[model samples]
Target chain A: MAGKPGRKFQLNEKQLGYAMVAPALVLILLVVIWPIMLSGWNSLFDYRLNDPTKSERIMTESLNLEEYADNRYLVEQGVNELSEAYPEGEETFNETWTVVQNHHEELVAEDAMASSYQEVNSMLNDYEPITDDNLRIQSIDGSWGSDFEAAMDEQIEAVTAVQQQADGDTAVEIGYLAAQLENLQGSVLSSNFVGLQNYADYLLDGRTWTALTNTTFFTIVSVGAELIIGLGVALLINRTFKGRGIVRASVLVPWAIPTAVAAMMWSYLFDGQSGVVAHYMAAVGLISDPGALLTTASGSMFSIIFADVWKTTPYMALLLLAGLQTIPNTQYEAAEVDGAGRVQKFFFVTLPLLKSAILVALLFRTLDAFRVFDLIYVLTGGGPANATESISVFAYKALFEQQNFGAGSALSVIVFVCVAIISFIFVKLLGSDLFPERAKK
Target chain B: MLKNQAGIRFYIFLAIFVFLVMFPFIWIFLTSLKPQNELTSFAWFTSNATLESYASAITTRPLFRYMLNSFVVSGLTTVLSLLIASFTAYAVTRLPIRGKTLILGLVLASSMFPPIAILSPIFNFVTDTGLRNSYIGLVIPYITISLPLAIWILATFFQKIPWELEESAKLDGATPFQTYRQIILPLATPGIFTTAILVFVAAWNEYLFALAINTADAWRTIPVGISFYQSEYTVPWGDISAATVIVTIPIVILVLIFQRRIVSGLTSGSVKE
Candidate 1:
């Protein structure tokens, strides 16, 4: 159609069109691109929330190592001056800083140990061993400032237990070494360039790679299974029947509910202690333990895949239903006229006509599956030795729990790149003409 | 004739399909209606029924507050998106826009970047704007995700409607806005309704940003509120079932009343012949 407008009115079709889509365009820019540009800029700098100095410049809050060093030095100098005057308690007073650092390091290490992947790890990740006896974990919440003494008191109970286990001033050396090691650990961060280094770190880090593998496997298997099940259900639903609408609606109900609610519901359904599915599995000799589904890789994958498939199949079915409706009954009838059997007709006619719809549905679901996070996060917290940890979950931990946004962004960028490449490959491989009719009209 | 057998086979298969699809929902409701003891211990449909679980779930939080929050947010998002998406779709498809294909491609490619990748930036945006936990923060960023699909659908809808309608309106001395409001809009009603319902459902069920942004349980949606019931010590499966059952029923009813409408909405009126 030519853009020739038979318009005597003030504004023509083109002007009106521009005016119409303007609001949506403005929002798309204000929200999506604006934030992404800002995030990219922020990633270039060393952004730390606890750093008061660089916080003003970056417009995002972050802690400064220099500021922290300065503050620590002032406190140490004050203590030294007091020690030189008092002369009696210098040793004990000087041990306080090391003791506090020791406790924080121990706590962080213990958490890391608990979450680290057991199998499927490279030997490069193994580090110098630190004994549990000397190590002391502080259970204080995420803070490291004026409440340092309060935090020290929080870890005091653990320290008390340690004192009972160990004797004398030797505890001081143990604490000092722990603190020294923690400082050494912090120094490695000095090499951070705020670009692809962290991304490289993620690829190099054994934990991240393991999470990546786990995530890929989860995505492929879950999406694959959902498609088969969804297509089968869609084919069945495409026929006329009593209460057919109700059935279609119910299938969508799972998809309609929030993922959080669905995740928790499935988790309960798979709970070993009193879960219905777990009980059946155990009874059938499918599982040795009641909640073994949550405990192992294969089991957790199955539970999560089941939830994903159950929730998402309706979406696939809905699209496939759309595809099925587009297929002319005459195609099947024409095949039958040629003496094609029902099975042969279905394979030749239905499948070919449904190709575009199948591709579209698969593309949407596959992309969504790759980014699976909240479902797995809520169900198992990517746990039981990191068996269920997706890259998103790993990145979330790096950003939030570990307070390492550099590593987090790096992983996110990798995820973006990988998803983009995969999507491009899918679109190309699925036939450029897959949705030709839709694209044409 | 073979036609009769084919018809019978279709119905038979359809019945089996419906059973499988309906089973989980029936189980959820039946489980919700059952007492906590039976829900954990007994077979799904056979248990003696009770209304206490639903009552407990409702009573546990400011259920009214959650419903209100959901309504206000979803409602606002629906209205705003309809306005934006309809106009955008109209402009690109009906109006003359330069590089329309490029813009559509950009928006479509957005699905490639999962919300997780964009979250940090969006987080910064929300925080910088001081919109953290605000309804606008959640809704605005959400429009980014939902709008692309809505716009695509609406554009397709715009196309299906004959251009003569707009042209005729223009010949009557109607301004562009007048032409759209008086002529083309009424014809696009079904498409608009589809867009509204889809956006509402999406905003209603959104969890990540809703949870991440909003802290207070009183401000939370049904999904986030249900998650808090899970503690290290106790998980109330009964209440969770009850809550899900409550949230699902209204949408299900909407589906029943508007299944064709929904299907049309989904296909962007593609099946109309």
Candidate 2:
């Protein structure tokens, strides 16, 4: 009986515990999971921002001579009727028939021009294809027989039916995509989804690859440099010194400055006439011109990476410093007693202890660098020919500037995959117990 | 003689390190004091200096507005986060919750979730709720951003507190809340201060959410202000340097005052986690 009470009590307790986690779980779903899910679904449709309802139509309006030629055939029949009306004026009738034929052809040419004008008008509606309404494809005029007209009628109806069907299908596909896309990058960007088409177009968009290339390059170089410099700084500051605390504070100042501010600060410094660095480099003849870096592609990338390295190096250093302190000075003392070199002590003890911290620092920084937009946006706006745009920037463009959220969402999905992969790798490399419990058993 | 050689090497190393480290600050300070006209003047060391830029940056904008937004956001975020995290951590560590370790690991893993990925949906949520460009929108995310660290810090600190105190307090018929308030909190002051300072700085320096959520001028922070001020091709460098100095000086002083607590916080923050 006593044990039976315990089971019931445990069930009630488990429910209450779940209630405690409910709020956080709800938040994570609302914020993180929802957007990720939405982006994935949006990738399946053609949602363009420029034309919410239709595609761009380029109609080639060459003149249609078939109608004019058909008028000639009708005139020949009419001429015979005229000749039959007056046999004495038959000679005059023949001369008049030739004139009549010429006049009919000219009139047919004008009507054909008017029809071309109508089709061009339809194409201009952002390629909203006109298939089922007042404009039936008129007959091929000069066909000279009922059989030819019937055949022409059949071809026209068939094309109209197919085009109308395609339009309805495309509209429906865009609609489905638009709904999914609206959730992710926001409907402010796009509201239509033409299936399979956006995917083809995305494959064609070079800006996606441009931003991808630049960002990937920036991430590697910046993270690589920061880790190296940060490790060096951590090692340098590891020893006993008089003013070490003050020095540590100074190192942290850059990290403490908000990244946006730090990014802008460097942007200002790289400007041609106004930047102090530009002026110095110009005076020393290191750079052939002043302020060229801010305006050039290589320079823009350099400025961003430099700013990122400056802002984040201290954070990296702090992580490595913590790792260094964990090495236990006794290892160094033991090495000294063993007549081992400094290099020997560093390799044997320091590197191994710092492995986890170094990885943690890299993981944090790399994820941050991949999602880098603010620094690039405020600094260069991906100017001077798409030099500084990252995956995040491309998404921003799709969502805000151009307003094509389907494509934006597809790019965001790519970013989400990258971050997930990196996080997975981090956990795999560091082992699941990276953040070990501090609870002393 | 060997000691002398080592001492000289140390001094030389210290000299070079000190110079490299101090160069940026010295550059900032010197540039901060320079006249606007000489900002582009090609001289490393300028004889003339003034407090004009700092004075102007303060006078040019509603400096107090930015400071107020930062303080309100940071202060409120710290308080709310600390209360939630402390309670949550305390319950996880002390209570007989089923699978507390699993729950704690889940919280730690939440930090790896990227903020930008969640930006749009949160923005939509806020805009829908009529909280966009408002102080609350900024504060809400700031708390979430700071939550994982807060829970981690408090959990680590709670682990260090002896369980005997709680047991005795319980034997004396003291309620859990009373025990926590009377015994645990007083001893946990160091941890509380460390967590507070860390959260405070983190919230204060947060840029993306603050910029994205608060588009209006009335509710902007220092980072947003600096970004706007950088809109020109030839930016106002002297004023920016002056602004940098203005923004950094307070946090620097805070770090200096709480030097001991900051060290312990750092030591614990990076403790194999």
Candidate 3:
């Protein structure tokens, strides 16, 4: 096959290279990049999944046909019933009833929306669910939406006046009609595109600022503690000693445990009432009271940072240990021969040689710490007044709990920018090239 | 050379270090074995021990099912990441690529992107596409997020293999695929093993995506499932600890066995320079 030129139909090496890498590249793009772009798009709108009116971003005015069709019929029937029950306000009721009917007809009579309304009405009549997005929500003209909203408001005011003139059941019926008209008015979905207003709001939002500050505080403290403690552990383990393997393996146990499980364990340990660790801390006078670790804001933050350090310091140690192994013993021996004591040797030989490793470890840990979520989420639930809420926790609350996608995505984007800045500082400012060896060439 | 006090001091420091590292695991184990009645007590140690919590942890909820879910998702993630990453790593390191450093840097940078930053969009995607609660939903992010680390590990290992072996295989008329399968793979087993362990641990421990993407109980992994104990009637400390122990065992075992390889894997990717 090799002897004959053009006999084999194999892809050339470069083509093969591209072919091999294409799946991974495409996967990263779709899974990582595409969702981020979607969030960016979402951040531009006032989309809230909980509210039917703003469930989706509406560039053109939209009508919630399901709510509209149901409410329109109710408004008309209720107005007629009220007018008959109270003949004294019949003139006012009748006039208001006609106006609502006219707006309703105008809304259903639109050239762009008439057919869709008919389909939706029939679907609602048949008691079938409108699962199709287009059928459930139909876009109407901008002028029609505003005109209908204005007409409904006038009708509501007229009905409210009529209700005041009536008594008991008649007044209640008129009020019901007015409520239905108000709801129908709400069914008109105007454009929710707030044009980066969510970002502006989040920037000024106190909770956002608090979350950012909490995240920064947590990252700095936790990463600093992890680096110092991890380096010490790494130095200790790097020495040739008996049972070092056992000690090393023991260190990894905490790192090996799932972070959420670790968080859960700490939550138990820091429990105010029955926590053993809390009991011991209180007994030892380190803490004034049992169960105070997770209740107070500062205490909860300290507990979380403590837990994070406990969980990740071993990982830092392992990374630093690798860097330590690379620093040859001859350098230390040379330092010793130069009349350098242990402290002097460590400061001169060990610290200088371990700079790159420390930077790498700090980079990884700092970024990981700044975006901390599962720990705070599981441990504190961002609780006792959201004292421990990291930006990620806040974003989760906005997106899921509040069902505010626009606000949530704005928060998510803020986190992305902060993380990008941290990464930029580490790589560009600190001169910690990710591929440090490659940069030399 | 009477440095006997220094030796004693070193052992004392090591003992304290070992205690700090092992105490949580021991405490959790002890808590898991304690009876339900003892849970409300602030005792340093329980007088009686029982496996009742482990029984409840397994029987009261879908602990095994959650474990199965974690296993499937993590296992699939490990395999797919290893496969995709191995190919990309091989191409980047062994092939005639012009900008290898640029590609490596990009891969490394991708890893540092905040996972939460992409959560909102991923949530929208999974819901809209009806991929919510499926294994593939979690696995998709897991694969991409873990790819950079896996690729870096594999590439560093691939770069160390002498080119002479591949050239000889080519001269013997073996295709690239055959060379990779027969020659390179056998030599790169250690790197592949370490990367697999790392990816599996990551996927198994992943909480945010699992919690966000999988709404159904059937699809929830161990970490997300154990969290349900938090929201239950009262905090089931005993059962939660048991579940934690269940989830932690496999990873602990892997770490115990492959400690050195994991250290190398973590460092070689970052601190090699």
Best model number under lDDT: 3
Per-residue error (Å), model 3, residue A421: 0.3
i-RMSD values for every candidate model: 3.2, 4.4, 3.0
Candidate 1 docking quality: incorrect, acceptable, medium or high? acceptable
Give the DockQ (C-alpha) for candidate 3.
0.54
* TM-score (C-alpha) between model 1 and the true structure: 0.77
* Candidate 1 lDDT by residue in tens digits, A60-119: 222233323333444455445534643444554456556655643543454543233121
If ranked by DockQ, best first, what sequence of candidates would result? 3, 1, 2
Compare candidates 2 and 3 on DockQ and give the better one. Answer: 3
lDDT tens digits, residue span A87-152, model 2: 443454365445444433543466764565455444543545444323322323332323333433
Best by TM-score: 3
Model 2 clash pairs? A46-A193, A46-A194, A70-A141, A70-A142, A174-A193, A189-A403, A272-A291
Candidate 3 local accuracy as lDDT? 0.83
Write model 1 residue lDDT over B147-260, tens digit each, in one string: 876776777677778888788876776677777777778988888787778777878877766766676777787667777777788887888778877777787777777777
Rank by TM-score, descending? 3, 1, 2
Candidate 3 RMSD to the correct structure: 4.3
Q: Is candidate 2 or candidate 3 better by lDDT?
A: 3
Question: What total of clashing residue pairs does each candidate reach?
Answer: 12, 7, 1
List DockQ for all candidates. 0.46, 0.22, 0.54
